[model samples]
Target: MRITTLAAAAAFAFAGSLALAAEPAQAIRQNLLALQPDMPIESIAESPVAGLYQVQLAGGRQLYASADGQFLLHGYLYQVQNGQAVNLTEQAQSKAIARQIEAIDRKDMVVFAPAEAKTHITVFTDTDCGYCQKLHSEVPELNRQGIEVRYLAFPRQGLGSHGAKTLASVWCAKDRQAAMNLAKARKDVPAASCDSPIAGQYQLGQMIGVQGTPAIVLADGQVIPGYQPAAQLAELALRAGK
Candidate 1:
């Protein structure tokens, strides 16, 4: 009887490993769909921490889950031994954002680029943000100093809200650069609609932990939240490329 019990335990262990081994991608998607059907699952992969699977959403929101999908986790996960956040989710999410950003056409952005273009900086911006306006005000200086600034709409509100409408209007404008200037100057642009990529970009911002307007993304996928002056931003962008 004891021998039979040992064999049964071995079988159970083998089955458990099989489940875990299959999890990095498919299992994560399955669980996310199970949890929130409307949430678009973009990618799933293994994390450095054992028993955790990283789930990336279409809008750039990321999360970690147990191999079997029994538990769902949001927010930063930490490693206690060294007193540092594991940030496994952030690492994976950043990679995913890099891929998405690469696929985006340069024309989709409201670009303020230097004539001599040294570095490219992508900012998730909202017109209502004071700091975002301050950042926008530095566009000429940024361009003159040789840093290219690209803008992606990230209305503080989610899709279908007033903020989203405002961003959509700017995106749908005949002259987006002019619309941006008007919006930044606190003038309302006529409500316009288009099948813009603003929705997807906003989603990406959330997944990448962008909490506010003027959130800057460097070439290396390190996110700098909030605004920085033109010269300071230029220096950071240079260092990021290196």
Candidate 2:
């Protein structure tokens, strides 16, 4: 009986070692794609923890799945040790946001770059949002401090609403930046129909989990959920590696 028990213990150790040797990147992604066919896979790789994969979706999103494909989790992932939160998922999200923002066309954006710019930030804005307007009012100050601000459309109202109409009008205007300024100042842009990228930007914002106006994307891809003062925003831009 003792001999049999010893053999069982050795077998269990060997099995545990085998599980530890398995690489997360190999097969879990294929299974996750199979499970959520519509969710485009942006990245998949081994995580800090064993038996899990860190999956970053396109448009600054993140999720996790087990190596065996038996389970999936989507939300903020925290590593708790010594009373501290180590967020591996947030790091993945930042990287994802950086990539997506880099892929945006410069022409479609309204840019305010400082002559001595040391940082770049992207803001998802809606003209009609009061807080968005408040944030825009500080753009000039932010730019003066060598922080470049890039605007992406996130109409608070869905498409065909007044906010969307205003965004579309801004895209249609001859001087895009000036039109944006006017809109932020509560002035109307000329209503001229033009094939604009307002829809695409809005969709991208949604994909990135931007649920409100004045959502700022720092250079390092970290998101600031709400409006920040110019000084604070500049500091965030610096930390974002701008």
Candidate 2 residue lDDT tens string, 2-119:
9999999999999997776554554666687687778778767667777777777888677778887667888888889899998878887888888889999988888988898888
> What lDDT score is found at residue 51 in candidate 1?
80
Judged by TM-score, which candidate is best?
2
Q: What is candidate 1's lDDT per residue for 35-109, written digit by digit as tens?
A: 678877766766667888777776456778887777888877656557655665566666666677767798788
The alpha-carbon RMSD values of the candidates against the true structure, listed in the order shown, are 6.7, 7.3
Error of 1 at 23 (Å): 6.0
Give the residue spans of candidate 1 off by over 4 A. Answer: 1-20, 23-32, 59-61, 71-87, 157-169, 187-195, 206-209
Task: Please provide the root mean square deviation of candidate 2 (C-alpha atoms, Å).
Answer: 7.3
Q: What do the candidate models score in CA lDDT, each in turn? A: 0.80, 0.85
Top candidate on lDDT is 2
